[model samples]
Every structure is written in structure tokens, then in C-alpha cells.
Target: MTVENEIELTAISGRRSTFEGDPRPGDTLPSMKDSPAVEAGSTMTMTPGLEASRDQLQLQENEEHSIEVLPPVDGGRQAWLFLLGATYMEMLIWGLPFSIGILHVYWTNTLFEGEGASAITLAATLQTGLLYMSCAFFGPMFAALPRWTKTLQVAGLVIGSASVIASAFVTKPWHLIVTIGIFYPMSCACYFPCATLLFEWWHASRGFASGMMYAGTGAGGTIFPFLMQGLLQRFGYKAAMVSLGVGYVVTGLVALIPIKRRIPLSRYDQDGISRIRPRIDWAFSKRKALYLGIMVIGMTSLGNFVPSLWLPSYVDDLGLNKPNGVALVAILNAATALGNGLLGWLSDRMSLRSTILISCVGSAAACAFLWGFGKNSGVLVTFAIIFGLLGPSFSAVWSKIIHLVSKDDPAVTALTFSIFAFVRGVGNMSSGPISESLLKYDTMRGVIGAYGYKNYGILLIYTSITILTGGAAGLFFNKIRDV
Candidate 1:
């Protein structure tokens, strides 16, 4: 209605309203039908404000369509090439760390000799823990400090390579704890923030991109075990470390070639003052999706290292040769890569709830039936593949979880990803000590993975329960989210 009309109605409202059984605030003073306040016939309408939704409607809108002059996004040759470089970066940076299980085997038996399992496991924990924990450093912080990104990335390259090379000269296992476990991983931690680039380049197919990027770690795991085994066996840890260190530097430099941002940037604005970027989104903390992500990632991660770190030893306990153990780790990693890619794709088609349930429950089942009752090498290898497919693929759902929690807001989604990463990292680090305690229960029996996995029966059960619990969280995510 016109302002004059609205004012006319408001001026008469105080006298009385009787157009019907009740009158709204913005109606013309109603002509009283029962009372004699005014004329009985009233010509007026109500203008109560629209309030169907508690939240104000259309507060924000997607601006991508309006930026007609922007460079290509979501898909292009450059975007695909950047993904390739990122995949290789994932392989090089994460290959050795992911396959630390192999080193855990060699060092405990050959290098460390009398050192306890917990002491040896500390090395793997530090390598993974520090790297995973690094998510807190730069992923969200880069918003306030974009200028330092390239500098930090370069510095990390140098430090990471040097750390690996330094590991070659370690005379005692403790020396490795510093060089390989602590320093090297801290250096590589810088790479975690690079994921923002992938997010910028591929908004629509983020799940697939995340999966492909993560699969690099599994791919590296597949190759590194055999390569490290040969080097450790033939030349020793010193030579192997040196060889990997050299390759780390060279390949990383090559990978940097294709790492480009999709958003167009001018030199003057490179510091990001004018650039629209993701901010640290705190609202996610209040959402169920965020907490559910923590449960899934945390539970899976706590049990994750158990298999990768213990599988080789499990083989040895079964009286299988060392090479067989190495082979199984490779198979597990290979299967993990495939599972990640497949599940990532599936997340695009279905809700993350379904994918998470599929991974956790299926993985828990593998732990129970395949790993639990293994009678021979055939069962062991099968367990590795099935568990790898169902268990480690839990990571594939992380991007989708982030999507749900952030509501596709770029700044908030970035922060959510880091929170999830930090949770998983803590899980990886803590599992080392936890698994050590679980190992003391070698005498227990009759649980899942009881037959051939006698030495790790308790550990196997722990892994299964945690994963199943995480899946239960997934199964109920929808119900909780609705509330």
C-alpha cells in the first residue's frame, strides 16, 4: 500500500478495530460491528509483515555469475593441470609418512633393537601428528596473512628436503625421531594449506578433486614400501633416506610448475586486500555436521594407524616373510587410493551420510570377518584390500562433511576443513600411545581377528569398535541434523 494509505490506517487504529473478530496493527481502524466506535462497514486490509522464516531471506547471493571478466573456474585445462601437480605433491610429501609402517617394522626389529614399541611408535606419531596438527597454522590464518604464503611454501620445501637428507646420518633411533619424525613433517605441514587452491579451482566437483588429491598419499604408499624395502635391504636406511630426500626436492619443484590459482590476480592486489577469499567461519562450531565430522574422522584415524603400522608386523607374527608384509601394505595402500576415488565420486551423487556409513560399517565388517578370522596368507591379503577399501576411505567423506557444515560459504568451509583435519591429526598422534597400551593385551583371544591375528586381537577389536561407532554416528547424522 502507499505510504499515505498506511499512515491513514495507523492514525485511526487507536480508536478501535472491529472489521472482524480481530484486527491487525496495520489495518485501517475497523468499523465496529459490535461496538459503536465508528461506522459498521470498514474498507481496509491488513499488512502484517511476512514472517514465515525466522531468518531474513536472501541475505547473501552467489556473485560468480556477475564476474564476467574473471578467469575460468570449476573446470579448464589449467585447473586439471593444477590437480595433477597437487596429486604428485601429495605422493611425494605424504608417500613416506603414510608408509611409515614399513619403517616402524625395520627400526623396531633391526635398528632400535631393544627399544620398546612405544618408543619406536613415537617416531611415526610425530611425523603424522605434527603434519596433521599443522592445519591449525595456515589454512585459516592465510586469510589474514596471504602475503606470507609463497614464502612459507618455499621455506617448507627447503626444510622438508633437508630434514629427510639429515635423517640419513642418524646414529640412533632417537636421532630419527627428531629429523624424520619432527622436523621433516613440520616442514611438509606447509603443504596442507595448498588445498585452498584446489577449492578455488574446482567448486562444483570438490568431492572428486579432494578424493583424487588424497589418493596421491595412497599411491605413494603403494610405491614407497617396495622402494624403501629394497633400499633398506640392499643399501641400508642411510642410502634410502638420501635417495628419497633428493627425489623429494626435484619432484616437488616440478610439481610446483602446475600449481596455479584459478582466480585472476593482479600484482598490486596479490597481497589479497581486494581479493574475495574465504574467512574463518566460526558458525560451523554450532552445527551437527561439524561434530559428526569430528566423530567420523577422529574414530577412523585413531584406528587407522593400527592397521598400517601393525600389518607388516602382523605378517611377521604369522611366520610370513618380510617381503610378504611389504606386499600387503602396498596392496592396502593401493586399495585405499581406489576406495577414496570411488567414494569421493559417490559422495557427489549421494549424501555424505550414506558414504560415511558405507565406509565405516563395511570397514568394521572387514575387520570382523576378514582380518579377525584369517587362516592363511590369502585371508591376510584379502583383509588388507577390503579393510583398505572400507576403512581408510573414510577420508573421502571429509570434503562433503565440510560442504554440509559450511553451507558452501567459501571462507567458512575452509575453516571447517582445517578443524576436521586437526581432529584427524590428533587422532593419528594419540593412537601411537593408545596402540602401544593395546598391544600389551597379546594374551587375549576369541574376539574378532582371533585366529591368525592372535598378537593383535585386542588392537583389531579396538579398530573395529571405533570405526563402527563412527559409522553409527554417520547413520544417525540425518536424524540429528534435522533437529
Candidate 2:
């Protein structure tokens, strides 16, 4: 039978009509003409063609209905509130680690006087590393136990606070590693995965929301270094830790109040399955775009911590003194906050791959030129601001990557984010040791070239090269479409 005849037959049999080809946008289905009325209890037999057409029409309707039910993107009371809560949590969870440079300097000079940069860096590395890694590890937990999100966040806050407080009492660096580095990050992991809720609440503006939320880290980093410095200078490490612990309790309690899932917890329930069994998306894991994106993220992450952890120390090495160093770190973080919001907004409006390319290249330029030959404080400060503006906020791009990989399916997006987090964590976790190894050679201290130069020369060159490579990788993303 002809396609139109089949559709008419389906309609006559009381089933919805389907088109021969895909329906054009705004096109309506053909209507059935009036026919002789049949008896009330009589059933009409449908041909095979009619049955197929009806089934296709029903499937199309169902798909369209599903699209209609998704949450409204951008501006809404609930979306704004969710963003606010997520941002606050981001500040508390990621801020301290970003500002760990101040603590790193303090420990090197006073507490761990005999230790090398590599050993001391391990603490901050572990803390930041675990923070990123936990997102991968605990993401499934958040999805499975949606009802317990608040409880888990509270537990994380308490653990992190206690770990920081306990770290103040330790005399050895390893003790700090265990309490502050390991335990604190474990706590943050519990809170961080809750960020995935943004996927459920946003669509068109997902990149902007992710950027604003991650900007909290920049805000915290900007403010906390000074707060930490003043506290460390006046009250000492022990008092500073206590004050941070108290502050965490107050801020975390307030922030947790508004943070909630947009969808009902029951939606994740798999026939009342236990919350511990994580639902992994193996199909997503097999995607080339996912792995390629991860490679780009991981390579760029190699240099992510280099500036945050070492810039202050590098300033001190330049004989600039403490306040100058703190100012540079603060400037970097301030720029970071601005970059996160701006880049995120740009990603939403422009090409995601292009935005990433710009960010990576700009960061590389800052590292090579501003940082490489920055013998003076003014040059270093400029480098800090420019690099901060370009680097560090790369995490915001994950929102776009999620959209590309999962086609905006919330369940698939969550699992994909976890995998991305895991791969990025591997890069971050290795960065500490890699940075330490780069800084080992003091022989280049007076050399002329960028690579063969003095303190931090090799480190700067390595960072610049890695970031440039990452920018180059953006070209391949054209294969993925919209990335």
C-alpha cells in the first residue's frame, strides 16, 4: 500500500497516523475523513502497514513528550538558588586547596624546614588530587543515594573541618598529609558530586551555570589566601586551622539549606535497588569523543597546579617577600573568578571548542612570555593575572563536554562526568611529582634561554608546552560536532 493509504488505514483503525518520511518542523499530520459509524463493541482489524505506521507515530509522540518535560534552561527561581548553593559549596570545598600555596610557603619556612619542595608539595597534591578524584569515585553514590545528599554533605563538612583542626596538632608532614590532605579531600568528595544536580536543572545555560559554580573556587582562592596569611602571621598555624574549621562549619551549614535536587529522588530508584550499586554507562565509556576530551583535559591539568602551588614560592625565591607573593596569588585567583564566569558565558554563546582553544593558547602565552622572563615583581604579577584569567577554570568546559557526549541525557551526563573526573584526577595526581621533578634542577638558575633559565624556568616551559599542546588538540574536536 502507498504510505498515505497506510496512514489513513491506521487512522481508520483508531490508531495514530504516521508520515511516510520524517515530519518537517511545524507540519501537522493528515486528518481522517468522516466514515460510516460502526457498532459500539465492534473491533476493527488493522493491516501490517497500518500497525507499523501507528507504532512509529506513537514512538514519535512519546519522544516529543519527553523533550517537553525537561526543565527550563537558565533564569528561574529554583535554578538561581541551586546555582547559589552550589557556588558556595564550591568555594568551601575547592577554595582552600587553591589557596594552599600560602600554607605551602608557611610549612616550608617554619614547620617543615628541612623538607624539600617535592615532599611538601605532596600534601597539597594529595588534597587537590583527592578532591578531583572523589568526584569520580563518589558520583555514583550521589546518583544512587539522592535522598541522602544533604546528609553526606554534612558528614563531609564535619570530616573536613575536623581534619583541618587535627592537622594543626601534627608535628610531622605525613601527619598533615593524612589529616588534611587525605581526610579533608575525602570529605569534599561527598559534597562535590552534588554539583551534578546542575545537569537536571539547566540545559541551554548549562555552561554558564557550571562556570558560575566553579567560580566559587576562584572567589575563595582570592579571599582565603589573604585570610590564611593574616591568620598564620598573627595566630600561627594551629589557630588558623581552628579558625578555618569554625568558618567551614558556619558556611557549610548555611549553604546546605538551599542545595537540593531538581528532580525527585525516587526517579533514580531502579525497582527499589540498593543505593550502593552504581549504574555505569559502559556505552559512553566507549565513545572516542569522551576519551579524546579526557586526553585534552588531562594534558592541560598537568600544569593546572603549577601556578597555584608554586607562584607564591617563586615570588619569594625572587626576593620579593611575603606580601608581594600573596598579592600575586590573590591576583591570579581574582582573574580566575572572572575567567570562570566569562568563559562559561562565552561557551554558551560561542563554540565550546573555540573557547577552550582560546583559553589554552592564552594561558600558554602568559606562561611563556609573562612568567618565563618575569625577573621582576611587576612582570610576575601581570603573569599571575593573565594566567589566572586563562588557566584553572578549564573545569567549566566539562558542562559542554557532557552535552556533546551524552546528548544532554541527564543520566548519561552524570556517569560521563564521573569518568572525566577520574581521568582528569589521574593527571592532577601526577602533576605534583612532575612539578617537583621539574623544580629539581637549580643549575639553570642563571641560564639565558627560556628552557635553560634559572629557578622555575624549566617548570614554566613545561607548563607552556603542555598548554599549547592542549590548545592544538581542540582542532580534533570538530569531528565530535558542537564541541
Model 1 clashing residue pairs (backbone): 278-411, 279-411, 372-449
TM-score to true structure, per model: 0.78, 0.79
Question: What is the Cα-based TM-score of model 1?
Answer: 0.78
Clashes of each: 3, 2
For candidate 2, lDDT tens digit of each residue in 1-483? 223321222211221211111223443333222111111222233443434467555543453112112223466776787789889888888778877877887888898887755666777778877877877767666656655778888888888888888888887777877886789887765456555777766767778889999899899988887888889989988999998988887888888876775543222224665333334456777776787788788889887668876776776766776347778878888889888888888889888678888899999898888877777777788888888878988878878887677664445666677777777788788876788897887756666534454457889888888887877787678776774
lDDT of each: 0.69, 0.72
Highest TM-score: give the candidate number: 2
- Candidate 1 structure quality by residue, lDDT tens digits, 195-250: 76676666557778888888887898899877888888898888888988888888
**Top model number, lDDT:** 2
Record all residue pairs in model 2 with backbone atoms less than 3 Å apart, i.e. clashing. Answer: 444-454, 445-454
The regions of model 1 sitting more than 4 angstroms off are: 1-68, 105-120, 233-236, 264-279, 442-455, 479-483
Q: Give the poorly placed runs of model 2, Cα more than 4 Å off.
A: 1-72, 111-121, 267-281, 321-323, 441-452
